[model samples]
Target: MQEFREILVAITNAHTSKAELAQAITLAADNQAELTFVSIVQPAWFENPLLSRDDFQSFWDEHLLAIAQPAMDAGITVTTRQICGHPFHEVIRLVETEGYDLVVKLAEPSGVFNRRQLTGNDLNLLRRCPCPVWMMQDKDAEQPAQAPVILVALDTSTDTPEQIALNRKLLASADHLALQEKASLHVLHVWDLYGEDRLQGPFINMSREQVNELLKETESTNRDRINTLVTTNGIGDAAQCHLVRGRASHEIQKLAASLKTDLIIMGTAGRTGLAAFVVGNTAENVFAGVDCSILAIKPDGKKHQAVSNETDANK
Candidate 1:
């Protein structure tokens, strides 16, 4: 819906998610978009450090070509790429510089290691990458394995407008799928004041009036923004707003579980460096907290600013 004319699929030879790849292909074909298959090769220093640089490059190129073969066989307009350095960084760099409307990659599995728990490379990419990321874990499955259902998760965050806009665009895709399977479009927003108040600090006994005021004022406004967004965009009926209260990610996880959503559409500002190392982003937290499939949108920094400027001009 947002002119996804160019798509980038990040893959690896080692157990790449076929379901995600199939999904990416389906999205591209549906939109008549071109696809670029990108695979990053960690230099095989173990093979031979003394190997010629050209030889190493050739090996990398061949590996990406091999990975690209499957998509090509499916009649996808595919291009192969090989890059050095960290996998996530390379992927993000490609998405931003190449102007890809969407990025499709495998979802990293959980129950693995400690470092990955807080912020793995992929999760970090989801936060900072300037495009949307679709993480797939199962390659053998189709993306819309059973008629695609679009679920958009909303919250009291600064990026909610972009998230809502993205959801509307994805709904267009769902509309396309509606012809095949009954596609349900849902917008979910969660609130957890008790849980969040605990994070605010140790119990400083607050009055019922105070609590009510906060919920009524701030929380109510947050819900209002969500309502305004959906209404303005005509994304769904007002009933589609599934509002709840709890721990942010936990609430979303519960709702996603209850809804059995096929895809969770959300946005993140992939943060890194000392600030992130100290306090991680919610997008990364959501990744660790949920089992449902996700499509993560990252800020391009200027995307919002540019949109605001155009809005002012039109006004």
Candidate 2:
């Protein structure tokens, strides 16, 4: 609902169903957000680098152009571009240069073991996309014609004032959808003492009373934060929070699957450099590993105001 003037949809040479195309186009039109259609054509040199150019290259371009035509005719201002390079790098560059508010991409097909696996290219973008990324399932690939139940994943470590504000806004949007689809909103907070904090060994040494006390404190804090968020934002009573103990990503993935959620809304810190690349953040770790669709929201730029204030005061 925030004013998003520019959005991008990344496509490929592969065929897309009309429903998928219309969904993307209609969502942009409804939000009054501009749409850019990008398709990366993998060069012939890679698979059979020895293959003749005229035969394979021409066919690739023509195929992509034909695929983009439907989106162009939908009256949803479309910008089409084909890039020849690493799909993830070009996709990242497009997002950086173009300054898209969101990137929409189709969810990869489900394999026997994995429900749906994100391509390495998609994985890279999901980890470091400049904006939130929406992985649309084939059935729900296009815009939701009605209101959608916004399922927000909340946890202790990533809790912040800005994140609460964003979740509040998302919940408000879901409230509107509730009137139409009668959508229900569910907030999930996963608290595992043995999670990435890596305290399982130490915690196991503690007495039963000590462990129960620790979990009690964690649950209390989780509930207090949820209460503060709901009370401050005046989120509807219908929105409820579920607290579970387990690995953060695995617990969240399980909750989303069990709830049959329409969307999984979670926050990311967008951490980079040695700290993150070497040891990934919870959001990044979860994005790649999640089965359900993910809407990863990076903390707003204003979250750094505290650091700026401290620096100025010190100076």
Candidate 3:
């Protein structure tokens, strides 16, 4: 949204999809930002231990220079850094130490190519990186279109101050992106009624009309809230709002695909407890399903400590 003065793009030795670099170069070009590409080299215990640090350093310098050639040709200056530690930790350290405005990385594709990708590292960066993280699915994609199609996935059911502020942040960012890219903006809210499964139970004596009426009320109320959100943010007619019914994870993926979204901007409200441990939220689920790029936003105040716990456990 805002002009990114500095950007940090994370790469793993195993995941060398050029799309990530392409996307980063495009962004850097758009913002006139400086770029830093950093990758981590964590040696395994089973590997040779006698390799000198100088050897590793030399290897990375050459590797990164090759990667930088593309950006250099695009008229953007590029630099690279090599770190030896957990990928996420090193990325976070770089962002904090250097004040990077955004982090970019490639999302691991499914099937055979998945083995070399770092799924956990992307999640950690999204959850813990203070700035926004852009996850590119297809590295070969050309620079986003001149008038890119953008979608902002939202959760409009909650009216809490925190959720409201989060919505504002999302809309603001989306609007900025649309203006910057000369893009069309769309707002999507996928809703599922509470206890929807319980309504079909034998114990429930509600008639079909009653059920329809109740569901209608819910849809109306949610529409009102969504409208309020758009109005409050002054999105005006610049963005079209779509309110659909279904599981958010599935619906979001479908909508983004249907819209041919160039970038899906969504927020992740970090969860807690067992559910947090066992699964990802709507944002994560939609991320797994979509093939387009994602710009994930964390709420203004919350820090995802669960990721910290998980990373520590892995260590």
Candidate 4:
């Protein structure tokens, strides 16, 4: 739980939910951080005959004031800015230039099958933003009285320094969040023997016992790794750890649902060039399956170059 020094909350529209605002305000107040409320006014909106650019500006100013009043009342330093540009691009540009440590925004629904999905803007921020992105989910119903559950997904199979750092980041973020909200923290690691089917097929023709032994060995090694990660991070017994054998994406969704998780803290390994257009496959799949809020982090020095590239492309 790195303390955020400067926090930016992006209002998707006038109707941004109160829950989202409250979450951002609470984080800022708790951290004693400066909070900024921002909204984007697309140039296309000005083309309509009914409204002038000044009218749009005035409307946004009023809207931001009304929504940001709670934060102001909490005695947190606050500012409001309304920029004119593409919403996603403008938000990233501000992040790059202003050095905000965290960006909070409500997740937009993807129209397919009426499922809650991350829109292109949300994905872009998760991919390109240099800082952590907290995407809050809209909830119409009240939460349960019991403690909220926060899950941190880790990939313990890799011993790479980058992956290890990411694991620590995810755990720290999740632990801090759980403490802040009086929530329960759960850590999860999914492991499997890659190409097990191929090994048992005619190509390799390994015996059933041998395949089983390999699976057992794989699980044992993952268990050791996850346990070491938890102990070394000072999490100790405060958090419950789960090691499951299955596909990473599917297991995550299943466990989150079973635990009724409120938020998931996970890493998005940054990509460059053409690959930067999409988030990591595991993260993307989990995003599509679970409707809970997500805090996506990137490993240190892994921030995508999309900001500079986009700026140049626009120029």
TM, every model = 0.74, 0.73, 0.85, 0.94
- Model 3 compared with the native: what TM-score? 0.85
Q: Which parts of model 3 have CA positions greater than 4 angstroms off?
A: 45-55, 73-77, 109-118, 142-147, 199-205, 272-276, 306-315
Candidates in descending TM-score order: 4, 3, 1, 2
| Per-residue lDDT of candidate 3, residues 54-103 (tens digit) | 77666677888898889989889788777767777777778767889889
Residue 140, model 1: lDDT of 55
Candidate 1, pairs of clashing residues = 17-139, 18-139, 19-138, 19-139, 127-269, 127-270, 128-270, 191-245, 191-246, 192-246
The Cα local distance difference test for each model comes to 0.62, 0.62, 0.77, 0.83
Q: Is candidate 2 or candidate 3 better by lDDT?
A: 3
Which number leads on lDDT? 4
Total clashes in model 4, counting residue pairs 3 or more apart in sequence or in different chains: 1
**Which of 2 and 4 is the better model by TM-score?**
4
Compute the lDDT for candidate 4. 0.83
lDDT (Cα, 0-100) at 133 in candidate 1: 76
Model 1 scores worst on lDDT over the 10 consecutive residues at 306-315
Question: Candidate 2, residue 13: CA error in Å?
Answer: 5.1
Residues 1-315 of candidate 4: C-alpha lDDT, one tens digit per residue: 678889999876454787888889889977889999997756676687898878877777888899889999999999999777766788888988899999998876567685566677667777777889888776654767889999999999889998988899889888888888899999999998999989989889999999999999999999999999999989899999999999998999999999999888888866767886655567767878886888888888875765643632221
Distance from true location, Cα of 235 in model 3, Å: 2.3
Candidate number achieving the greatest TM-score relative to the actual structure: 4
